[model samples]
Target: MRINVLQHTPNEGPGAIQSWSHDRHHEMYIYHPYQFGNLPTADETDMLIILGGPMSPNDDLPWIKQERVLIQQLLDHHKPIFGACFGGQQIAKTLGYQIGKAPHKEVGWAPVYRQTDAIPGIPEQVIALHWHEEMFAIPDQAQLLFSSDLVKNQGFLLGDNVIGLQFHFEPLADNVREMAVNDNTYPLDHNDLHQTPAEIIAHGVPAENKQVMYTLLDYIANH
Candidate 1:
């Protein structure tokens, strides 16, 4: 299967998603719309994975608008999509939902509770890394899948093929460190929900975290 990842930045790559693709023996392609502005067609992409970024979906940038158009096309064709952070917000925006600032900026590792058993392999509560100040609203027809203390709409499942997660389950230790170093705008000023840079990189990616990401990919691939 061709798993195409729409990467928004250089630092935030596919991370554990690349490992999962390699383990599954699927071809993985990463496109940098922020750089070359290249994107794959829905017909050629078997599965689309949207990575996290510092940019907002509300940005009036050309590539951002173009990415949303591609997402809409994929949705129209019933193609599978898995998005994290800003990518999740893109999916919500394409579906006509509003995107805005979260109640509080959730950074570093945090606990997100499973809201439903529709998608198996997700625990009742799992600790996942988050680094977003913006949030996606749950669409009317989408199922609320996860929620955190700071953000109520942490995740949502739209149809059987599309899944959006507001947290990072795919970032490894190095991925987290790079993101923390490159982005210094995390709202960690006396915020209880926000973790410091030192604390964020201290704990490496858990085995269970990678497994959960793999489970999500497998579910999206097979379903």
Candidate 2:
């Protein structure tokens, strides 16, 4: 399978997703739109994976709009699409759903409760990394997949091909540490749900947790 990842920032590159691609021997391509602008051609992509970012979907950035156009095209073509965090919000907005602030910012490793039928190969509750301030309403056409104490719409699925996760399933321990250190300006001190860098890293990345990510990618590959 050929997987194309749309990365919004250098720090949030495809972490565990890249490991899955490598172990399966799938061809992987990355487009850091933050650096290169929107250059991926829809025709060249088979599976699309959009990673998280600090920016909101409604931000006036040029690439945000351009990526939305690409997302709509991918949805129309029925391509398998997986989006995380800001990417998930973009999917919701493109599907006619509203995106806005959650009651609180959910940062650090939080348990995401599965709400739909079991995801076949994945677990019910997983401690996934999160670093977002905004959340979105599940699109009317999507099946609610997962939820958390702080965020009700943690994930949703559209048919068998499109999946959107509000949490960070692709972050490795290193990625989490990098994000916490670099993005320290995130209202951590002001918010009750926020965690310190040492606290988050102390939990570390679980092996089974990473396997769940591979299972998701495997499902996407076969779909």
Candidate 3:
């Protein structure tokens, strides 16, 4: 199957998802809209994975609007989609949810409390890489899957095909470092959800989130 990933920046890539695809021998492609904005037709790819980034959904960029229209097209065609962090917020925005400034910025390895599951592989609680300041509300008819102290809508499942996760369960240690490097404006002054750089750098483990990511990918691919 062809898995196309939409990347907003050079730093953040498909991390563990890319590893999963390689393990399964699935063909993968990446589209960097921040550099050159263009999208593939529905027939080109079997599934889409929207990756994390420093950008917010509220930004009024031409590329964002174009991506929104493309998202609608994918939804209309009943294509499967997996969105992470900023990508997740974009999906909620496409579904008519109000996405804007979050109350707090969650960076580093944070604990996410799972409320429910559409896929059985996800545990009751998982620590994922969190790096975003924008939050999203669950769209109508979507099942709420997870939540954290900083963000209420951590994850949501829509129409058996689309899934959005506000946290980064797929980022590897190298991916995390790259993400940290790109993001210069860390809100350290705010007491809300700000962790020091040393703490984030210390928690390094690529193997931690790989299996769960593989399980989720298997579920997404088969179902």
Candidate 4:
């Protein structure tokens, strides 16, 4: 199947997901709104994967508003979607869910406690990359799937096809390192969810997370 990745920034590319698509021989197209002018129609894409960025979903940027509309359109059609961090918040906001600052930002590697009964395909707990200051209320039509100590609303499922994750399941060791080097706006020292670069590197390799991501992709592919 063809997958279209909506990349918000140059640094935050579609890490492991891109590799998975390539290995599966799936057609993967990237649409970087920061570089591209507009989003494509639903007919032009089979699935949508929205990546993370430094920007918030509530940002007043014109492209953000346009992307929200496109997200809503994909939802209206029941098209499969997988979003991370800010992308997740955008999906929540477009679905009439509330988006706001969390008590604190979750940075580095953290374990997300899965409400397994809520989502059949996911595990009980998964070590995911966290790098967001904002959180969202689970949409009324969606089912809560996961939660973390720092962020309660870690993930939600809209219908059987669409999924939003506050944590980054697609993080590679390089991605975590890039985040550590570039993200200075959010102070991570006092945050309970913060982790050291060594800790993140120890577990953030593609081999460690590939099965988990593949399971998610399989769920999306089947649903």
TM-score winner: 1
The sequence of per-residue lDDT tens digits that candidate 2 reaches over residues 10-128 is: 77888999998899888999998878786577898888899998788888989888888988998998888889998889899888899998877887888998887736867778888
Candidate 1 local distance difference test against the native? 0.88
Candidate 4 wrongly placed segments (more than 4 Å): 118-121, 184-190, 196-199, 206-208
Model 1 steric clash pairs: none
24-49 per-residue lDDT for model 4 (tens digits): 88999999886776787788878899
Worst 10 residues of 3 by lDDT: 184-193
Q: Which stretches of candidate 3 lie over 4 Å from their true place?
A: 187-191
Superposed on all Cα atoms, model 4 deviates from the true structure by an RMSD in Å of 2.0
C-alpha RMSD for every candidate: 1.3, 1.4, 1.6, 2.0
lDDT of 3 by residue, 1-223 (tens): 9999999888888889999899999999999888887876677869989887777888889988777887888898888888998888888999899987778877777788777767887878778888777889999889898898877888888877888999888878887777666664563546365666666767785465788777766776776
Clashing pairs in 4: none
Q: How many clashing pairs in candidate 1?
A: 0
Ranking by lDDT: 1, 2, 3, 4
If the candidates were sorted by their TM-score against the true structure, best first, what order would they fall in? 1, 2, 3, 4
Model 3 CA lDDT for position 22: 91
* Segments of candidate 2 deviating more than 4 angstroms: none
Error of 3 at 220 (Å): 2.0
Clashing pairs in 2: none
Candidate 2, residue 168: CA error in Å? 0.7
TM-score of every model? 0.96, 0.95, 0.93, 0.91
